[model samples]
Target chain A: MCTMIAERASIQGSGKTENAWISIDSCDIYYDHPDHVDSEHAITLSFSNQLDPINSRISLEITPESAKEIIRKIKAALSKGDSLER
Target chain B: MKNYKTHDYEGLIAETIQFNSANGDSINAYFAKPLHKGKFPCVVLIHHLPGWDELYKEFTRKFAHHGYIAICPDLYFREGNGSPDDVAAEVRSKGGVSDEQVIEDISGAVDYISKLDISDGKIGLFGTCSGGRHAFLLGCSTDKFDAIVECWGGNVIMDESSTNEKQPVSPSSLTANFSGSLLGIFGNEDTSPNPKQVNEHERLLKAENKDFVFHRYDGAGHGFNYYDRPIYRQEQSVDSWVKIFDFLDNKLRS
Candidate 1:
């Protein structure tokens, strides 16, 4: 089923494709069927350059637990880095 | 009810052809027909949100083998080229195909098949998931189809608050206009059109005095017919296929 559950964010970042690094202008996070994942549903983090085609993007599909863990790790790293700087 | 013969000649021709759909967009379609010299009913297949994949081609041929001319149009032709999954992912990001465009494309297919030399002018619709929703939509929007088979179509009873440019209205709202006999195949475990929603759909049809039948499987969930997926249920899938053919035979081959 197409959950149609999605969220979009406009951000600036650089991501690697097959052969080159491209400037990504947008990111889309959606929970739906995965293209390659074995699970019926996965939370996907997709980064894309609007100039390129829609499919020409770097994407990740992981379980809900994995997504939460990534979020935790990112916050932990940021907090520790900030403390060190201070 | 079998679409085969024990001791007779059997063959079919399947190929890809392009035709103008909505707004004169030339879209590709896979068409299959029996080689025998006889008029046959046409089944315009509506591929699911998975884009135009190999499974649908297999379905087109399966119908042809059973003496029906089948055609599955590429609903995502305007979205550019890529693998089926890639294209489907892109379509999903874009909020799915618009209901109006799909209806026009399907209407065009019906028109195209009606002109075929072997056409019996009896057209039916078959679709799964989102495609199933579109099938029911078209069946109600116009009197073009003689039969409709909708398999696990989600969002048929859309929330009014969620209506958008793509899907402006719920299909259930248009049940009063339905002209064809319908066969609904659903799984009770499905989330989108859960058992309660299915009951609502059935109730709406009954109130309108529409010609429709529904079958629900207890253990099966969404996409149970998708053999490649983990949710596939062999017992339910086989039984549903038999039901589909029997329903089509009664409605279209009359």
Candidate 2:
């Protein structure tokens, strides 16, 4: 005897004028952000679906001022130039 | 060459030495010497891109401890306490300090060091980063330097674009002009003079048959000798210091 099962799952959320969605299958996972997503925000995702669907999606909203701070730190690290690996 | 333990002589009669450059600009420098001093060998220490700071003062103290009269000149005196970004922006916008000005300022320091009663008229030049570039420039501009040590100076083979003043400060061109042996220490990972540029510099010196020693350390990035910075490498710094002292002893002291 042989049996087959099919499952469908979807995630949706909105915070500080931003929204995102995640979809998963046994073979592939997909994530999408709405066109209205703010430029000041960053998106991060983590998942534990090794064979098929990736797990979770995360969205972080960051202001322009914070972006500048992030740039400064990156510049400092990059100042070591091509010689340093970080 | 004897190694003396480092000592701090902060707030010890650090006098400002000012003079008119050949371009009719006033140059400011700091002169530090032992309170009890006979004639001493003088050293002209040049500041890096950050200009004269506490590190320079500490260097003066180190030189003074070894019975050497030390002078550290503010290469960018016109703009005080300005950030490196400011200097870089100015250079990109209106061009920075001229090579003529650098030569004049350094020559003036050499003259001042030579004229000092505590000096034997035998002087050496030491610089880091941009100041290191100036040390090479000063050495090429004048033979007054008995010895020269440059740390992580960029592009010894000068180009019109490399120098703001459109002056050629290449080591290959200046090799024959140099009357004293030179020491150049750089980090292998330094992006300024990537491996290719360093190899070219070595080739130039070899072709010119110049008397020079070059050392490039692995795993060290640009400005690795700077203790306050995260890139500081203790092993390379200590080893380079020892080599510098040896070079100075053989070429300047003896």
Candidate 3:
């Protein structure tokens, strides 16, 4: 199915493309069909610089379980950083 | 099954052409047809949401092989040029293309094909996935098409919450207006138009007394005919193709 489900947000970061590291402007998150992944569907985190070409964007297609675990690890790491600062 | 004669000559011509779409915007399109001289039915192919990529080009040529003049317009042409996947991802992020714009582009294809001297003036619409949904919508919106082949079309029954400025109305709502013969192909395991949704779609069409036939395959999911994906089911795909050709023959050829 062509799920038109997607959400976008402006973000501040830099990501490396084949050319070089470019300033990323926005990100889109969606759970839909994968272009390369073998799975039927995957949660995709796509980072892009609006000022750059479409191909310059970076993307990660991961399973739902993988996405959840990554979120958990991210929160844990952030909590550890706060504790260390305190 | 009848086999081709040993001395039969088969030839095809395929090329990319640019034409004006909605709002007079020029866009790229692929056209394929048999080289032999004969009045042929035309098929306007609405490419799936994955964008107008290589697979659709192959599909256009396949129709040409089967003696139809086929044209597939690049709906994502206005989104800026890039690789098909890149452009598709961009369109996906932007909530897909607007239903109105797509209708105009496909209408442009119809106009282009209709003008050809070789055309028999009978046109059929074929599409899969979101394209299928569009095919259903176009068939209902106009009397131009003789047949519509909708394969695994999702969002034909869009809920109110799914409605956006792009796709504001559920196509199923126009079931009463559908006048063309329709052939729907679905996979039982698909979720978007899961069995329940497919049932509801059929119910709506039935209520309108529409002329349609639906084929549901067991053990197959969405895009079962896409050989590039792991979900491709060879047996189901072959059977569905047979059904499609048969349906088109009855609807457009007869």
Candidate 4:
């Protein structure tokens, strides 16, 4: 598609990066061209705090299959408390 | 190297320039012109949604090398400066630039070009993707240009459910207000301004008795002229570029 197929979904998680612990306030996920990934289209997700543009950014670009795998792994990790990785 | 023909000395000066729009908003733009002195036709090149990046600057230089003055305003200038991709991402997350503000900025650009000592009093307009839609919008909204070329413009037909909040009306709706000659290039595979939409556009223009030309290339999709993207169609882009230049020369020069 020419325009982004995007959605504003809420994410619950916090991660530390660049010597700062940034809480993700907003998340925008879309299926579109990935800047860093050399793919025509991919699942792009950005976890950010709208107020702090600099501190809160965890961008991920993954293939559809990879995204599904990540979802599966995440579910297993949360349920089992310890999940096996391939 | 490809033996490209040049009508003048292929020297140019390109740099970032600041210009105040009619709204008193100072914006940054990539300004380029031929180093050689005579008055030259001006081009107000609107950058695509992909942020005003290196490719656009290259286009500016290309025009300058071809003996024309060109300026591509950074539409994201109002937002704090950031990398092109980051700026684009931020703008998209914020729902993009407003159509009214964009129109005002474009008005300023046209005014700026008209006052330049090196200007030949002729201004050519060009844009692709979202910028392409803006070119068509400006064409109908004002008589500030001599020629306009819109390449694969999306959202001009306005899918209401998918329309961005910033753009309240479809450019197609204002077809009756269009002035000067317009040259539109599209891809048969594009869905935004698909073949059906293009047909309707032509029909409306004909009904209004406006002077415009439209062409659709097979085996090409949206952003086909974008050399760096996966959608690039080399043959069609080359053909389209030729058409754009010819249109400018025909309308602005003779």
Error of 4 at A36 (Å): 5.6
Q: Arrange candidates, best DockQ first.
A: 3, 1, 4, 2
| Runs in model 4 lying further than 4 Å from the true structure | A14-23, A33-41, A54-56, A63-86, B1-8, B159-165
C-alpha RMSD for every candidate: 1.9, 17.5, 1.6, 3.5
Query: What is the DockQ (computed on Cα atoms) for candidate 1?
Result: 0.47
lDDT of 2 by residue, B1-254 (tens): 46544584333346777866556677777778866645778888987754466677788777776667888877777653344323322222223456677788778777777887878777888988767777877777787888898887765666655443345456546756766778988889776656677787778777877788999999886666777655678999888888887887777777
DockQ of 3: 0.65
Show the colliding residue pairs in model 3.
Answer: none
Q: Judging by TM-score, tell me the better candidate of 2 and 3.
A: 3
Write down the worst ten-residue block by lDDT for model 4 chain A: A32-41
Per-residue accuracy of model 1 over B225-251 as CA lDDT, tens digit each: 888777789999999999999999898
Query: Backbone collision count in every prediction?
Result: 0, 2, 0, 0
- Report the TM-score of chain B alone for all candidates: 0.98, 0.86, 0.98, 0.95
Model 3 residue A61 distance off true place after TM-score fit, in angstroms: 1.6
CAPRI class assigned to model 1? acceptable
Which structure among the candidates has the greatest lDDT? Answer: 3
Candidate 3 recovers what fraction of true contacts? 0.60
Q: What share of the reference contacts is kept in model 1?
A: 0.32
Tens-digit lDDT track of model 4 for B159-219: 5775556888988899999998899999998876779888988899999999999989999
Each prediction's DockQ against the real complex: 0.47, 0.02, 0.65, 0.32
For model 4, residues A1-86, the per-residue Cα lDDT tens digits are 24656777776777676688778777887776555565556787877777765335677888877889999999977878654332
